[model samples]
Target: MSVQLRHYFRLLSSTTMKSCRSNKLLANNFIIDFNGFYRNMSTVAEVVRPTDPNLPVEIMDVEEYRRMNGIECFGNSVADPIKTFDTYRWHPNLYRRIKEIGYQTTTPIQAQSLPIVFDKRDIVGIASSGSGKTLSFVLPALMRCMTSKQDLWPRCLILTPSRELTHQIEKVIKSFRFVRSICLYGGVSYEVQEMLLNKANPHIVISTPSRLETIFQKGITKLDNVDYVVVDEADLMLKSGQQSSFAHIMNNLPKKRQTLMFSATWPPSVQKLAEQYLDNYIRVNVSQTQSLSSLTVNKNIEQIVKVVKESEKEDKLLEVMNELVPSVTGFIKTIIFVRSKRTANRLVKFLKKESFPARAFHSSKHQEERDYIIREFRKGVIPILVATDVASRGLDFINVKFVINYDFPSQMEDYIHRIGRTGRYKETGKALTFFTAKNIYHKSNLIELLKETKQTIDKNLIDLTEESEDNIIKDDNNNNNDKDSGYESSGEGNDLDNDEDESSSSEWTSDDESTNKTKKL
Candidate 1:
């Protein structure tokens, strides 16, 4: 046999063994039987498509993940089980809440992880974003807290990478009503979080890595009696800025606690951290065979790309908006993802100037404004939100029709979460991304992810690439596609324009000139 064929055969054999190993891990880690789900893994992995062609989108069995090693996923892996109350079978209150939320079925991550957590077992869940892994731990953690005596300040501590996700987890925990929870993050005042830490004596504490370090340093509360600890978005926590802060928090946690580490993607660093932090833990995977539609939203999204000259990007953004706004008003809400907070603010300001009702959400906004924007967006009063990657993971906004990557994501994993914001609740949606010649080199991972999803590249968006030149930009073609391509030309060597498509007035443009919009930054 040829070398390529031999490699393929070896890969297949390894996958079969890995599948068996993963099953054993789940059995050993969670005490659940999922052999029924894995019986047809060969057929399931063979069929890879972007969208699920049926109702109540079928969840992939979480057991099919055994094949993945390193950064590559050989087959579409199922997420860990996101166990519901029925999956627990012993928890009635959780069951009632599940019914109340209208969640009749358990997603794969929820199925695999929930039962293990409910059983008070330590676990490391390696599912992708939008895999319902939050609820997997939340349900069980809250259940454990509810059953335990409530005098402790926080019996369960959940750590996430970003401040936004801390708030999201707090919201989900509060929905339980049975569990009183508090969110602690750096951007918000430490005084307020400390106040809640004292008065609420919360059952759960949702916090970002830095804030947790501060709490430990300040001697705010003892971690001596903590029973459950969760590191949500753990992979991102391992990123440069957060690694030290997380290590400090890990050192402070009680040694005899049930530790859980959850992240969208499990990289080598995260795996190493798990070995150090998690004990006899189970690992679970639930990335879709394809796209975000398998999770909450963006499943029906027909992602299209628009490549434009760096000088003309702003104009193209507005043009895309002009064509999309009317339809978005009727069908679903929209979110535009920008690379920086300044850009987010600029885009929002530009849209408002054009009489489009839009809001900018990022770490820069005041706490009150941030809350207002999220509340307004959730209530459907505001249809469009311009945001940074801060909104990417763990924040669920239902009925979002389109997710536009005004800037391509920095990480391949982040692109998945960014687009995941739309096409929720079994509805169809669309994703549009603008790739300029300037950013193509910086965004190669994003390009690879797009190709994996089987997304199509519009000719208008394909900037030509030199074989050796990773950073490439295509020459602009002044094609007469539309009547109003009023893009501006910034004279910088890069030829990048901040705002050309949307008409700008002196009154609307802010005096501060920065790339990102977030005021706090």
Candidate 2:
């Protein structure tokens, strides 16, 4: 062994460990201890790189691999790309679990990112939501524990913005029978976290930055074993009110370890943040550059914008749900996003009074209540959920058939994320936004987003943007499309075939509209 490698192994023999700042991480805690790493990292004068025994021998050139996968990356170096989950040699149970999960093919992000991640290189992954970015880092982290020394109890740390996202990552990690994890966030119980730390002895620690800091400050947990760190939704972290916690955590980690940052949009704040802590990272961005607005809104989402007065929003929401909810049992999953906690509460009461079973979700709810509501919503126990922007981030659902913006979000980024709640995983869904006169200030941005997605702009929205809505046009043409093609295959019947809407609008077409309709959701 080289002098450097020999010296690193010496430190690994020590019994008691300090918190997290590492002088030599490769010898102490990096996930991979492959022979190629020793040769490539130690011998700078070597001419021809030896084949990686741990990876497949048939490595393609970098440019050709990028072209095949539709991946755009800028970096000093990259690893061999992956075509399927079987590309890497995984433990039999891990491979079996992936198959059981029914992932027949890798998404674009997954195919491009898994190889770089498995090579233990730093990465900044930018792709739309539902592009399978979670598993890109998650599978690699779990693989570390599956292959590591038996005493290295925790080998990875995952940080995200919200409590829901914390649990989501934990769920993915626990899919492996050998991988145990603890989830932590602010609103949850501290006693439960302490118990898990003392008892679970997990292989991964998934948390919000602030909560992880608290656990470490109390001296209950040590980061000495963490060689891999994943920052999921890195752009949202900048605004998650835990940037200081993130900085403190970064300052204390091993200097030579690997880091992965994933986000829906590649904002400058995130890029600058990545440069400070990440060393020689590769950036994997999808579709196009970050200058585009519709990065996260999938093409499968059929978007509808209806201009209604502020007072008419409640009625309009009920009407939309009535048209979309297919069965009499009312089991379709839908989410309505409001601007404030108060609005969310009021809307839930209104929805319940109007005979639509609903739940309210926001920051003010007790952590137990939030967890219960999310579970119920995800399992289809609750058919409709009225929530604030909190639900817009990383909360995954079974099948969100429709989304309604009872109030327009504060910025276009939030709008992109909110609409992304549906039409996930290449499945078709719908998003309907209630645009009132109060939201006239958002005219240009909304119109630009619609035009970029090739969606038809509402006539009322155009009038409002062209001048002002002093005399707002009452004619909204997008309503006709929804009237004809709604969940017909959902076991009840077609929404338009009902007697209620048959005599209502002169705008509604007769038998010709149903025959000529392009969509049959």
- Model 2 ranges with Cα > 4 A deviation: 1-70, 188-191, 289-294, 326-331, 466-521
**lDDT tens digits by residue: candidate 1, 215-298:** 778877667777789888776666526788888888877889899877766666777888898877766555443432222223
lDDT of 1 at 203: 77
lDDT of each: 0.61, 0.69
Per-residue lDDT of candidate 2, residues 1-521 (tens digit): 65644554464455422332442234422222222222223221111112323433222344555666557877866554555565565766777787788765578788678877877789988777677889889888887888886676677889887878988888877766678888877754577778888798888888888888877888778888789999998777767567888898888877768899987777677888999989889988765433363254466788899987655767788888778875776658999887765566667777777788888776655555667789888888888888877788788775898898877765666777888889888788889998865566567767877876778899988886323434443463532233221111111221211111011222212112223232211
RMSD of candidates 1 onward, in order: 11.5, 14.2
Candidate with maximal lDDT: 2
Clash number for every model?
32, 0
Q: What would the TM-score be for candidate 2 when compared with the true structure?
A: 0.75
Candidate 1 residue spans exceeding 4 A from truth: 1-84, 149-153, 187-191, 288-300, 328-332, 442-448, 459-463, 466-521
Task: Please provide TM-scores, in order, for all candidate models, with all chains considered together.
Answer: 0.71, 0.75
Sliding window of 10 residues with minimal summed lDDT for model 1: 46-55
